[model samples]
Every structure is written in C-alpha cells, then in structure tokens.
Target: MQEFEPATDQLDEAWDAIQHVADLQDAWAAINPQGEQQRLDDQLDRNLVQDSDDEFAEMEVPELQSRQNIHQGDQPRCAIETCDPEITEEQAQHMMRQLNEKQRQVFNHVSKWCDDKARDQSVDPFQMFLTGGAGTGKSHVIKCIQYYAKKVFARMTESAEDMTVLSLAHLGTAAFNICGQTICSGLKINPKSQKEYKPLGEESLNTLRVKYRHLQLVIIDEISMVSTTQLTYIFGRLQQIKGTYTDFGNVSILAVGDFYQLPPISPPTPLCFPHDEILKDIWNPLFQIVELKEIMRQKDDAIFAQMLNRLRERKKKQPLQKTDKELLESRRVEENNLTAPPDALHLFYLNKDVDSHNERKLASLNTEMFTIKANDVDQRGGRIIQVHETPHRTTRADDTSLASYLKLAVDARVMLIANVDVSDGLCNGVPGIVKGIEFCNSQNMPIVVYVKFDSDRVGAKTRTTQFIPPHYAGCVPIKPRKESFKVRGRTFTTTREQMPLKLAWAVTVHKVQGQTTDQAVISMKGLRKSMAYVALSRVTHLEGMYLMDYDESRIFCNEDIEANVAKMPTCDLSKANPLTEIDHNTNFVIAHHNIQSLHRHIDDLKRTQK
Candidate 1:
C-alpha cells in the first residue's frame, strides 16, 4: 500500500472520501463493459439484490436517461421528443365504443395508460399484465393497442424510423401468428446447448443491443408457457444490453397469458404472481394489470362461458342438471354422425397416440408416402443430422418425430403448424387437407406441399410452403422451434423442423389452445389433469363437443403431476448440495379461486342478437 499523503487536521476526512470516489471510477473504468454487464446479469439471475437507494446513489455509475435509453439498434424509431400521444380521452372512448361494455372498459384503461406513458417522463415506458380466460379478448386488446400506438406515433412525426411495437411469444406458432420473433431468436439463445438456463452470451447480448436498439414495447403473448427462469434472464439480459440499471431498463413489457393453460413443456414452469420471487422482481414497478372478464368469443353463449370459467378455475363442480348433462351427452357424435364431413376435431392427450392415429389414418388412405430427411450439419459442415443424435425429453417437434425427417401422404387431414402468410390465412390450427406436393427435381425430392385451407377458414384458396430443412446452425430465414430441457444433470437442445404441417386428424389439446372448432372429439385417456376442460372449451358451442372413452375424473388435470421445483436463482445461491434431479415433467395448474363472474349475473349476460 502506498503511504497516504495526509491533509491538515479535519481536511483528512474529506480527502479520504474524495480518494474513494476516484478509486471507484477507476475500478469501473478498468473492467470491460460487456463482461461487467454479463457478470452483473448472471448475479441478478442468482441473487435478489438488496441495495438501498442511498447505496446505489453513492456509486460512481453513469446517470441513465429517463427514456429513449432502452436501445438505438441499427434502426432508430421516433425520437422520444416526437413520440408524444395525441389521443384525447374522447377519441379513446370513441374508438372503443364498438366493443362490449367490459371490453371497452379494459380497452379504455389500457388505452389511457399507454397514452400517458407515451407522453410522460417517468422513465419507464407503458407496461401491463393482461390476463384472462379463453375468448376474453386478450389478443384483441393487444392488437387494438398496437394499432392505436402506431397512429399516435405517426401523427406526432412524419419520419418513419421503424418505431417497433413488437409482439414476442415463447413458441414459433404463437410468434408466427403475431408476425413476431420467438423469444429464443430475439434474445440469442443457443438452441443446441445442453443447459436449461442459457444466459445471454456476449454475442447474443451484443446482437440484442443492435437488433432491438430501437425496440419500443415488447408484448410477451402466451406468458404461461414461458418458464420463470427464462423470463428472469429476459428481464436481466435486456436491462444489461440496454445499459439501464432500472427494471426492464425503462422498456415496457406487456405480458399476456392464461395460467390455466399449459406451461412450457420442459421444466414445466408456469409463472404465478407473488409466489414466484424472481418473476415478481422482474415485474417490480409500474405495470397496469388488466383481466378482461367478458367472453368475446362466446358472447352469445353465457351458459357455455360460465361452465368454462368454472372448469378453468378448477372449482368443485355442482351436481350437473339432468338437461345439462344430457345436452353434453347428446352432442357426442354417435357412430352414425362420427364419419360425417364436419367430423369432430380429434383431440388426443398423448403424442404417441396422436402420431399412431394419424399415421394409421394416412396409411389406410392408400397413398404414396414421400419421405424427406432433414438437412442438418455442424458448424464444420459435417452432417450431424444422424451422426450426433440428441437425447429427447418432450417438446412440440420431438413429440411429432419430425425434427429430423417428415413423412406425409397426399389428401391427409392436416394443420398448418407455422404461419405461411397471415394475410391469406396460412396460420396455425387452420385445419385443412394436403392436396399435393412439388419436388425439387426429376429426382423427385420433395420441395413444396400445396394445401387448401377449409373454405370457412381461408375463403377457399391454396397455400404453399417450400419444404425447408432446419439448419442447426440457424442459417435459413425460417427458424424452427428450439426446445431446451434438462436431463440427468445436463442441458440438452432439440430442434423441431422440416414440416410446418402437423396431422390434424388428431392434435394435442395444448396445440389446439387459442383455437375454435365447430365440432371436437376430446379423448381424455391418460390425461395429467384439468386438460380435459381445456379440450372441452375449444368447441364454440356445447352442442359441438364430443367425448370418446372419457372419464369425469380425468377431465380435471392430474394436479399431482405439477412440479414443485425450488426457484432457480435461490438454488444457484444456496450452499447445500444442489438438486441432482431437475424434473422437466409436463404438469401444470392455476390454483386460484373461481372467477366471481362465473356466477352468472342475469343483467350482465343478456345477449343481443346481432
């Protein structure tokens, strides 16, 4: 240690304080920003930082701007000065007047909240957690806000700077439906990594810094499927890349999902408020919470909506009325009606069952099966397609057995798994038939499959997708769903790719969430729990629901299957021996009381015939 240069009398105390400040600045200056940020981010992932305001104030950190500091990416959106809202309260009310009373209320609440955020200088942008049951217009409200925000920003400035108001989803189908990027792609996750908690590497952090430099608002749809650990990283990494010490770095986060729905397959983590400490920390600060009660999809059928609400909440069921029980029973397609053109959409509880059923159906059709092995290669250009087999746990593509290869016959009932073009109605769950295929050359390797969506779905037009293989290195424009999970003390990655089409003759209930079917035959054999209710709710009307070999007990999901893993951050910080087994079992639940509105209000539910 260097000998201290003493100041005269009381000046020594002041000299020591000044020396400490210089030392702190020098310490920060010595470290690389990117590495320091990553270290801090990882620290956030593993600890609940308990710094007092005064402690942080004493640090020699650079002062961050209240707004417009999230990112400037390659594209700069509107300047903060020019992005003020012009929507008057009257205009907002007028725009939402077409919605139902409940919808209008939620819309107005979110509209005004977003409006204030657009003009306010509180540092944090607009954020929300919009939750609701199926058909509650969660998606509708998101779209409305997206449209309104654009108009407000446009009216403020003439220059279009690619002001991004984007939607992000945990899965490819959801992202595609919203015309947005997947969380994995946006955040820079190494899909091939064998680690469950893949933090953002420098490359990923830098990429996010550039790509989303101008990112405005982020809407995470289907939040239930995203694990808490995954979300923790998203929050922490975004803050790190944006260089803001504030929560979410002053960027807005609109999280939309129903916990009653299925959670992410691996780790099977469903985000619950307050209970999940890490998620709670990420959600700290100003976020408008909105739960839409009215069922916009089933607006005319108050009874159906009530039943769904009760079922979704897992409430103790009241004795079924004789007529109500008969109504559900009568809707079950007997052998005579089962084979009709408007066949019930088959819902299977197991992946194997769905695969075997669809395969058998296609085999029985007496058509030639075309097989296309996926084109997979390592970074060195060596083919890892078959050479390096990844141990599979459970994922959307793994369950289908199409990540490596896809086999299909013409005229098979199918569902478009990826969005080909939303404008023309090429979207997930649009039940259709595979009309034919076009091969690459005379050698007859498959290229594109022509599909004709149901007239009721796409207004009678053919949609075509060029068969693209998954570049494990992610070379192609199309990014397949990357499913990560843990098995036997290591993280493993599995990519599901090639066929954007899945057999529609039978689909898993989780696959069919956020969809409506005129008729559905839900088989409840071997269900984990409460998923039967989810399957049953897909039918637009009660009369269209069919149950095959169903049991009432299995209709409620198997609550025992839910994983009770300790919080990841806490686990990482603990001193004791860590959990050797990380169970990625697929179990889910929303242990909340029934919605009060389920007790139908005669006045509130009176339907108007349009």
Candidate 2:
C-alpha cells in the first residue's frame, strides 16, 4: 500500500488505472459470470494483487487514501485573477422555479430518470432523447437535469469521481452554452473522414480507457448537428475502451436537439436515414424520446410564433395581416433602414460576403491592426510544419476551426470560439470587442488581446498547447498533441493553450443558430429552408428582422430525416394534452410533451436571462 501511494499529480492517474481494471472486470463478468474472476486474475499481472485464480474484489482505496485532500474546485476556468465558480444546486433551484409548466415537466422527468439511476446500482443508465424546437427550453432543461443529476449522484456515491457526468455538444458554441466541450474533443474521436476513423489502435484504446472508464453518463446538446457516423464512432470507441458491447458502453446517454433543425454538415448525416440506421446503431432498446411542445422563445408574440410555425410546416405562405405585414415588409423594402441598424449583425449565406463586410468594417474603423502567428514547434523549439496546417476537418477554417492567420484590430467585433471562462459568462458565441492590446515589451509584437466581453475584461492567450491535427496518409506523433495559448484563470487550469476569439462582425447563419439578437439582417440566398426558420427565429420580433429578399425556396427543406425520426416512439405534449399526468406516475418517461405558452411571459424570461 505504501508503495502504491504516488505523487499528488499521479493520484487520479492511479485511481483511473484501477477504475479501468474494474471496468474490464464488469465487462468480463457480463460475458462469463461463472469464470470471470479467475480469468481476470490470470490475465492481469502488473501492479494487480489478485488471488491467483479466483477473486472479485480488491482493497485499493487505502492506497489512494494514504494521501488524500479535497478542496472546492472551480468548474469553469477563468483566464484572470479570480476563479469562476459554478452555480450551486440551491442557486439553480431558485432559477428553475421560474420555468413554466411545460419546462417544469421536462425537469421533473429528467429528475426521475436520474433518481432511478441512483436507486439501482446494477442497472445501466437509461438513455433519454429530448425533442424540442428552438425556444422550447431544451438548453434550459439540460441545465436543470444536470443540476439534479449531480445532486442525486453526490448523495448516492462515496467516490466523487464515480458521480461524474460528461456534458458534451457537437460544436464549440453549442458546447459552451451548456458548459461542455465539443464531442470530438471529449471522445477524442477524429472527425476528418468517416472512412479513416480507427477506434482500436493500442495507444488510442489506452487513452480512452484512462480518460472515460469511470464516466457513467453523457449529455449531448445539438444532436441535430451530429451525423450518424459520428454517433457510431463515439459508441464504438466507448465500447472498445470499456470492454463492453453495450451502446455507449452501457452508459446512459441524454441527447437534446430539434429533429427538424439544420441537418448535419457531412455524410451519414440526418441520423434518421433509411431503415433507421442511426437509431439501430446508437439509440435502440433502452432509448426514450420526449418531445417539448412549447415555443417559449416567442411566448410573448403569439402571432409571430404562428408565422414561424407556418414557415416550418410549409403552409401556404399567406399574406400577412394589414398591420404586422405592412410594418415587416416596409422594413425589408426600406433598404436604408436595414443598412445601418445600431449593433445589428449583417448575416450572409456566403463567406465572401461575410469576409467583405468584415473588411469594410475594419477599413472604416481603421484601428491599430496586429496579427499573431501561431507557434507550431517541436520539443526543441524547431518548426514542425512551416506551411499551412490543415487540421483534419475539425480544425479547418472552412469547417469552424481556427484560422492559421488571425488578424485582430482594436475595437473589432469578435466572438469567443472556446469556453474561456464559463462561470464568468465567458462562453463560446459570446460577442465582444478588442478594447486594447498589449505587445511584447521588447519584440513589439502582439501578445495579449485585451477583450471586453459584454463587460468583463479577458486576456486572450495567443499561444498554448492543444490537440494536433491527425494526418490521414502519414505517421503522426505517438503522443499526437500540440501547444497553443490558453486562458488559465487563477481558479482553474487546462492544457488547451490556443487563442479563443474570432472576428464576428458578420458570420454564416449556421453559426448563429439557437442565438438571439436585438436586430439582424439576413441575405437568404444559398440557405436551406430549415436554415431560414433558424435564422428568422433568431430575431425576437418582426421589427428586429431585415430580410434582403424572401424566396419560396428559402422556406423549404429536405424532409427525409424528419420523416424517419418521426417513426421512432414519441411522446408529444402541449397545453391541450397536458404534461401534468405523466410527471408523477409515468414509465413512459421517454416521451414528454410540453409546448411553452406563446404568451407575454417570454419578454420577462428574456429580461431575466440576460
């Protein structure tokens, strides 16, 4: 036991190793319960003190306890002076009391799901699929469930690590809102090409086992953006890592998103493909589906909400009423009013237009401009790849990855591309401007971009360590990682060291989903029908939108995926159906329905939300 006690930094490492062994034991027992103990005893030798040929339990905690200390750890790392602490469950409860009936029902269902998990130690976690359109409180419900899940697990488990849950999403912005990370980053799965993914490499398996063996739950936001191939890749990697054949390695998965939202960006996508391939692959026997019926985002504007419903349902585009239609159309017709709305983002369908708008704004401001070259060096400080580094697909500029050449100007509009500090309100998609800059005292090169996000000042680190892009045709480093600047507030620390800000004067509509603004003008060309609804929904009211022109094609989208997903067992809820009965005595926890009331309550929620 004395020999097993390692350095402080290595405590979790040792614990993780033990956890992996336990994972393997569980998997082996499931396979052959009669002889698993002996088989495990015979195969593992290094550091494993097992009875020669028959043993099921071991005394390992005393070794880790030989040197144990606990402190209040900040969840989201800040880049500056104070550590940003997570909201306590008590605080979350106070906020949750604000949810309407439909929102409350969703929370209650998730609470019971997790509560059942706490009561049963032998049963695997039950998977949950929460279906809702924008403003149905999908994101809000996710936070509430996360809060309650943590509360239940903390009470039931002795080991804090055992109660841990993984919160993940498909993209940085989506992940940021939920205080999570990109699925690609969390699963350590490469999204470069569907054909090139290899889940069973020795080092890869070892890495996955070490990182996720003890994790019991996963919550994925923006399931709409996740392709079937990506889902399969995640499930496959988890199975290999945990040595289990169960979907998600027998871990419970809670997926949240709108089925009719924008389809995935790549292949094997629109997960509801022919023959229900995606459902069969990742969501099946244990999967539960809950659909939210409320349109909380526009609760205050019922007529406008109805207009949106018509757009999504592809109803005959009827002429607007004399009052609202004239005001909205006049706003569109008066091109001058659309040109210079204060604090309005000029949305576009093409990158060229976005780039052109950014260039013009930069030129007009004529602020002091500075550029920082990324540091891509080896252990000895020698350049690794001198030319452009195209990170598989995840890190490429074309596919939402950071740019190789990032030009920054003081007073320029920018968005945080990563979760720099979650507790301090520094999240992905948070817009800000470079208030000032600091250069190397001697080198006279830009070192820190002093950014004012809303109000909090954050220093964006320009160089830090990060995951290296995987090469398809060449041998990659055995470790396969790189260095980039990261914001490490005094409270938390992370290995990621890359600058997290990107220019945001204008951006693609896809980049703006699930976000709202005071005013926005969209160029509807080149966008899908669903994309139009997503873009249109971002504006709170008709007065806030300035459409360059509307085309019939803009409101039509591919319906194959929607039709496929609809066939899955579903529980839809609205005021008419009422979610009241199911909250208490419903095993149909998989299907929940509660469309938010499209009343005046929305404006109140928005005021409190900001």
Candidate 3:
C-alpha cells in the first residue's frame, strides 16, 4: 500500500487543470458523444495505478497524471463548413481584430473550451452571454466571432467554399429580411408568390443530417430581443430535426445583444428579471459568460458617456449650477413646445389663440432660414422644431386620424424644410421622402400617399393610405380639387383637407427612453409619478432638462424610481478572464468542418457535370 500526499501548490494546479479538462469534456460531449465517452474511458484506464509502493510512490503520481492528460488532449478538432457567399475570410479577421482586449479574451476562452471538448469527444458548450453597455463593441465582437467561424470553415475545406452565416437584427422588417436572406441564399428559394420557396421540412433535415452531421455553430445576434419562449421554440425545432446528431441535442447557439436596450416586445412581458431568476430560468447552463467593458463609440465624449452610464445606474440628480439651470431651460424650450405657432406644446397648454383660430395662428409662423454669426454675437436662434398633427375630420371609421394629420403637415412644409413627425405604423424616427399625394374623397382630401424609402434590397415604392372614417364625404364628383406638392421639381396632387397645423414634438418617455439630448423640455406635470423618472432621465446633463411645471418631488420620490434603480444590472468587468488556446483551436475545427461540408456538396455537383 502507498501513502501519497499531494503538495498544496500541486493540488491547486491539478484542480485547475482538471476543471479546464472538465470544461473541454463537456463541450466535446455536446459535439461527439460516442467519441467523447470512449476517450474518457481510455484516459481513465491508462491513468489507473495498479502497483503497490512505499512512501516515495506519491512522486510517481504526477508523472502518471501528465501521461493521462497528454493522451486525452491529442484528438483532432471538430470542424464545421459553411457554403454562404455573404461572409469572407478577410472580413472575419478584420472583425475579430475589432474586439476589445477583454472581449477577445472571452471569445478565445469559449473557443478553446469548445475545441478541447471536441478533442475529448465530449459535450461542447453551446450557449454564451456577451453583456455590455451601448457603444461597448458587443455587437461588433459577436459579428467578428461569426465571421471567424465562417472563415475557419472556408480555410480548412479541401475546396474553397463559403459557409452559412445568418445575422439577424432585433427589430421588425430586419428580422424578416434576415430570415429571408438566409432562405434565399442557403435554400435557393425565392420569396415571390409564384416562385415561393417551400422548406422541405423533414427531407431538408435529413439531407442536412446526412451532409452536415458535425455542424458546429449557429450564431444569433440580438439575443436580448428574443424571448425565452421563442428560444425554446427554436431549440425545440432544432432538436426535433437534428435529433441525436445535434451537438447538444441542438445547434451550438451564440446569442449576442444588450439586455438593457429594448427587449423582446411580443407577448408584452418583461424581458429581464432578477439575476437569481435569470440564472435559474433564462440563463442556459451551457452558456459561457463574457462581458465587454470598453466603450467604443463615446470614447471621445467621456463626460457624455459617463452621464449615460450614470443614467443607466439610476443615480439621483444633485443640485445644478446656474449655467446648468440655464442650459436646462433652453432645452425645455426646444423640446417641449412646437417651434411654430399652434405647436403641440400649445395644445398641451390649450392656449386660446392656438386652439380657437388655428388657421390664422399657423399662417403667421412663416418659414425663415438664417445662420449663426461668426462674430461672438448670437444670431436669431437656429433651432429645429418637430410638429405633430391629427386630422379633425374622419373619412372612414377605420381610418387613422393621426395619419391624415401627418400627411397634411408634411404637405404643408414640403417647401419649408421643417422636420415633420408622423406616428404611423413605422418605427419612430424613420425618415423618408414625401414623394406624391393623392386625393381620396369628393372634397379633394388627400387619403393615400406614395413613399419611396431605401431598404437593404433597393429603394421600395410603397403606397400607404390614411385610415379614413365613414362620415367624411367621398371625393366630390363635380370637380377635382387641385393642390400643389413638389419634391425635386416634381409637382404632385395634394388635398384641401391638409391643414398646416404645427406639430408639437412629443414622444412617450419609453419611446425616447435610452436617448440623450443636449437639451430636453420634459413635460411631466400631469403624468403619473411612475412615468416622471423616465421623462427626466431623457436629458444627458441636468442643465439639459427643461421641467415644464414638473413636480420635482414626485419625479425624485416616485416608487418606480426606486424600483428602476433596484432593477438596474450591476455592470462590473473586473473579474473577467481571457480565452485560452484550446478555445481558438476548437472554433477553428468547427469552422473547418462546416466549410468542408459545403465544399463537398460543390464537388459532387462538379463530378456530376463531368
């Protein structure tokens, strides 16, 4: 019998090594189960000591351990090949280099862990979390990781081929475009009705399983926008199709997005919860955690960046200096009221002049253009104002009154160069040219308009009609109402119903929640106490906030304020570690395999042609 006591230092090193080995094993099992188990068994068998020894036998243990480690570490990396033309190797390298030191390290760590597991034939880590503030290069880093994987696949393949890299955005239209693009490129399907692309369902799965049973990764961007329910659906579908061949009974998912920004909107449920709940429910155990710290966008504006960071922290406002107070007042004047007469601000205040004699009041606010003087003297103010309008008359019951008002406002200012705010079925702040207008009723009211907007594909021409209520008279049959609207010297028909009402720039705090302005006129006087904090936080500097009859105490003392502060996630990056060599190798292998599969398919086509 041998009595062996491992030194404390040696024990610590051994434990670290074992933990690393275990991580690798877990990743390997995810990719290649049979191979992983066999390798583990072989290592155990080789490491088992049968000889009985004296007091010096402990010295032999370290040598035996080293042999076992070496034997278990020599397996080939797992490879995944892609066949999509969207991503290139040079592009991937460029993206990877963009990552900050901390992010790069974390990526490398995950890659190594995945690679080690592949070598050991064990389950591979399939999920990862990349957390950071705005401008932290989180999105950029994830894109690089995706590109790197694709590039590695291309490089390792025998025949040069591209890999499938689907990059989905978090919002509307973008989501559809991403999925459509993937289907178009990967499945060779057209979206047009006559040439509609139909997924082959089980057949497609079978083909993929036969050709790419060793597929390595599926990277999903904007993961924060995806609900757990949606994720479960995606995973469930993958599990059903890939079945046993799935790396972890599904594809290795790399989801990247900021959790703080707008979260998933569907189902109207909260996206983020307490850390404990997140860890237990939303956080996948296989996910390797990585937090990026460097602020890339606002690096030059440190003070502005700090203000944003503080805003995220939900810090209370301190007393402001005189200059700050002045700045705040200026901002309030700019953001809260309509720049022109009959502004939304006037509507808010219900000014008698603006409400009773709208036509006369709006006519006097003529458009003027002037530049600031070079001499220190201030020229007439050159501030831009936003106006919102809603039509008073309804042409149809279903017609959106807001749309008619927006069209009328835009038409009124077609030549004046004023920014018009139209709260249509589009994302806020989406700007487009007002191309043409058409009258819908006998009164020559403009109901439908044509808009040409730029999209990923090309400039799309879309015709949107304002929801008209039934009471409004249809276009008068006796005579066509003639109105002049011009864009680039092209005259278009306009309607008499179009009123030149000034729009007050007003958006719910939630809509403008994450944005910061140099100055803001926040109107929280009548709003619920819960919403006051949101309105106040919209400004960057304390001086930027213009309080319009706001209850300072209500905003500062609201229960929601406390809740928001308590709910804010702590963003500490001091404890993060760098990625290991094994991670890089694993990522390389997965990329290689994916590219190889695609190349093989291309080669088969060539052979058939010959």
Q: Which has the greatest lDDT?
A: 2
TM-scores, all models, native as reference = 0.62, 0.66, 0.44
Q: Which scores higher on TM-score, 1 or 3?
A: 1
Relative to the true structure, candidate 1 reaches a TM of 0.62
Candidate 2 stretches greater than 4 Å from native: 1-85, 161-163, 193-197, 200-214, 275-280, 284-286, 315-330, 333-340, 371-406, 416-430, 441-445, 455-501, 571-610
Better candidate number, 1 or 2, judged by lDDT = 2
**Candidate 1 lDDT:** 0.52
Model 1, span 190-214: residue lDDT tens: 2222323444667546756766665
lDDT of 3 by residue, 283-391 (tens): 4334555656666656665654554453333323544344434433454544457342222211112222222333443344433211111101111112212121332
> Which has the higher lDDT value, candidate number 1 or candidate number 3?
1
User: Candidate 1: misplaced stretches above 4 Å?
Assistant: 1-95, 155-161, 190-207, 273-288, 316-324, 334-342, 364-366, 371-405, 415-432, 440-444, 452-501, 557-610
Model 2 vs. true fold: TM: 0.66
Tens digits of per-residue lDDT, candidate 2, 462-500, equal 112233233211111111112232122211111222355
